[model samples]
Target: MSDTHRWVEIERVEPGVFRARNARGGELHVAGDGGELFTPVELLMVAIAACSAADVDVITSRRAEPEELRARVDAHKVRDETGNSLRDIQVTFTARFAEGEAGDAARAALPRAVQTSHDRSCTVSRTVEAGTPVQVLLA
Candidate 1:
């Protein structure tokens, strides 16, 4: 396996708001108080959904290009005596393809593709399932 580490830098834009940028220079805005931008938890959900969708899309496209594709992730958060955390997460994916032999093949492969992504591929989902270690540093 290639040992490449990816990094994202987060900077405070203002009270309760921040901006994060990846090494590739892609940036996103985050808010802590449910502002106009995405919150951290929402971003996490997006990451998971996007990762799975990407894998599914590539696999499905190999059989037949989808005319339309969309993925949505819903998470339930619980806060109690123990602490606050995501209690459950659900992912839904939809794809539409042209009517033809290719479309038939793609339709047949869609379920397997999604299953493979959730069970094996989809790094973000796997990471979440495995649990991640976090460290904080003062700068």
Candidate 2:
């Protein structure tokens, strides 16, 4: 299988602010601190949650439209010998289905959908869990 190459160009917008643009022209602002823009750490959590949500949504929505489905990703910012990093990362899901046969079917599939996403489908969560190393290069 061929995987799409993912890359983004982060251009400095101002002091402590940057804009990340993907090849398709999507852009989002980022910051380290002191701004409305999402911090890098927060973006990481979003990635984990969004990736799982995508996988789970596709699976469960096929059964029935979701009444409500959301994931909350959180972690503790810690400074240790390992330097600044996150710990105790958690991804919590809140899903609700309406009272109906279709809803019941969706409900039945919810647990499996979430598990499959976490265990095998969500690349973001898997990468984080695997402790993938980053190779930084100077341009």
Candidate 3:
């Protein structure tokens, strides 16, 4: 196992807005419009979507010219007696390749990318599944 302690710092800018800054100096801005309760889960879902799309890009680039790609990630959380959390995530990926290509091969690649992301690529999903500490910061 790699003992590198990967760190992600998130700072709360408002009630439902947060800025996620990484150890490598990368940053992301996230927010929600409703109550303060829903924003965090949405952020996780966005992470899944983004990571899945990235995986898809990697898969497609190896075979053909990728013109466009998009992903939609949906999650369901089941609450227990103590109002704790149990989550189920599903990601739907849609991609469009450049014309005059083998459409079947391009179409087939989407599932492989989704599997790779869910099984290997997405860090947030892995961390959450492993019950790691997810730190929340208030600015």
Candidate 4:
């Protein structure tokens, strides 16, 4: 796989359901019916949040491991004449550290880590915030 290019192949598993496979053998199921699998919109939100969370964790965890860490993404799914889109997307993170000097160091680093991720390091959230044109073609 080329570093400059990322790709995933999605194949229909059944009506209203599909599986997306990456070159590294990662797979996720997407479904539009019955709420059994992750919907495409949810996957998008997950990607955005996970990217930032991973960035923040990698930076902060070096100081001290977090006792608890979680990330959540919220947005309005809008459908209108313009088409379906997400608006006012927000990613939130909750982190906790054990009581100790190392924990204090990590606690102090948390805000900066999150800020840096949101402002620069995280590609997914940055891309979403900056916006980009996605070109689709038949294959």
Best by TM-score: 2
TM-score between model 4 and native? 0.94
- Which residue pairs does candidate 3 place in steric collision? none
lDDT of 4 by residue, 1-139 (tens): 3258888999998999999999999998999763878898899999998998999899879988898999999999999999999999988899999999999999999999999998988889888878888898986
TM-score of each: 0.93, 0.95, 0.69, 0.94
Model 4 residue runs over 4 Å out of place are: 1-3
Which of candidates 1 and 2 reaches a greater TM-score? Answer: 2
lDDT of 1 by residue, 75-123 (tens): 8999999888887799999899999999999999999999999999998
Candidate ordering by TM-score (highest first)? 2, 4, 1, 3
Arrange candidates, best lDDT first: 2, 1, 4, 3
Per-residue CA lDDT of model 2 for 12-114, tens digit only, reads: 9888999999999999999989477799899999999999999999998888888899999888999998799999999999988888998899999999999
- Distance from true position, residue 29, model 3, in Å? 3.7
Candidate 3, poorest ten consecutive residues by summed lDDT: 32-41
Q: What tens digits encode model 3's per-residue C-alpha lDDT throughout 20-51?
A: 89988998766666354446667777776787
Over 4 Å off in model 3, which ranges? 12-17, 30-38, 77-80, 84-86, 102-104, 130-139
